[model samples]
Target: MKKLICSLLIALPLTTHASSTLRCDSGLISLQDSTSIVSSKCGEPISREFVGYREVQDEYGFYNEVAVEEWAYGPRNGMFQFLRFEGNRLIKIDSKRGR
Candidate 1:
């Protein structure tokens, strides 16, 4: 029983960390694609969230405020994908296992 519990504890995070992958009409979309481009290709996400602004340093040691947003797509009998965008560019895509 203790082993089962320990195993479950160790596995919980791994399961939760699973995320859905993005599949575009022409295979996977390229990184740094603009949000508008993604929207055109993948259509609007199921859900959209504005995470607010963040300050980032540029190459010239200048700081700029960028808008951050998290867009969630459907589980669709599969994994749910979350797209993170900074300003208008896609920064990352995360997938989570569906229920």
Candidate 2:
């Protein structure tokens, strides 16, 4: 039981960091920023995707519907990033590794 508890405590931080919100450009990109802001600041992405309606749970624990979108950016031969947007709000950013 003690070993299990210790292992869980050690793993907790990894899970927390895994789901942590992502930021870009020293805080230029944040969770609450709108898609328009991202476009103007980050310029046009290399690829864009419309994910359509998705059922989501809000901070208040209420289920709601939201429109999801994804944008990908890459600079020539550099790393590529994937940004997810929900209802015009930037929600998540994922970087492609081993690029």
Candidate 3:
């Protein structure tokens, strides 16, 4: 029992960090998916906000400004999923319980 509890505790953070994927009605959306792909699978988010711009460096050692945005889709099971995008790719997925 103790070993099981310890294993579960160690695995908790890994699950939390693996929130980079979301299941939609059509398909699954994951990190690095394009904005168009996410929108198509998720069928449009409830809200989209322009977060700002991030400077990203490429393999060529050139830095460019990429648009950053957050798209929210929710109240599904009383939880909201927020997707963060940089440049045109989905970078992160977060979920929170709604009030």
Candidate 4:
């Protein structure tokens, strides 16, 4: 039981995780980066998609609808990167190996 617990603890950190930053030819794009910055650094994704609109609340408790978009870049080194944006800020980054 102790060995199993130790092994599980050791393996936990090795699990895949979503990245918050992407390295581009010009610079690194990170979460909360503006769309313009990502575009300038990454030089346009292979595809730009409008996922939908997300409702967000402000500090004042006013609700606003923001555009949600997903951009795909790759197959760089046999992997593809997907970027998700809410309004004009990058919110998430994901990567997957191509088949």
Per-model lDDT? 0.70, 0.65, 0.79, 0.81
Candidate 4, residues 1-99, lDDT tens digits: the string is 345434333534333348989999999999999999999999978777787899999899999999999887776886677789998999999876654
Tens-digit per-residue lDDT, 1-99, candidate 1: 345434334433345443234686545655688888888878877777778999989899999999998777656556666688897888888766553
**Top TM-score: which candidate number?**
4
Estimate the overall C-alpha local distance difference test score of candidate 2. Answer: 0.65
lDDT tens string, model 2, 1-99?
Answer: 345434333433322122234444434676768999888778777667777898988899999999999876653344455678998998887654322
Clashing pairs in 1: 19-95, 19-96, 20-95, 20-96
Highest lDDT: give the candidate number: 4
Ranking by TM-score: 4, 3, 1, 2
Cα displacement (Å) at residue 35, model 4: 0.6
**TM-scores for all predictions:** 0.73, 0.62, 0.79, 0.80
| Counted clashes in each candidate structure | 4, 0, 0, 0
Which runs in model 1 stand beyond 4 Å of their true positions? 1-21
Stronger candidate by TM-score (1 vs 2): 1
Tens-digit lDDT track for model 3 on 1-99? 345434434433332323878999899999999999999999978777787999999999999999999887766886667789999999899876644
lDDT, candidate 1, at 31: 60
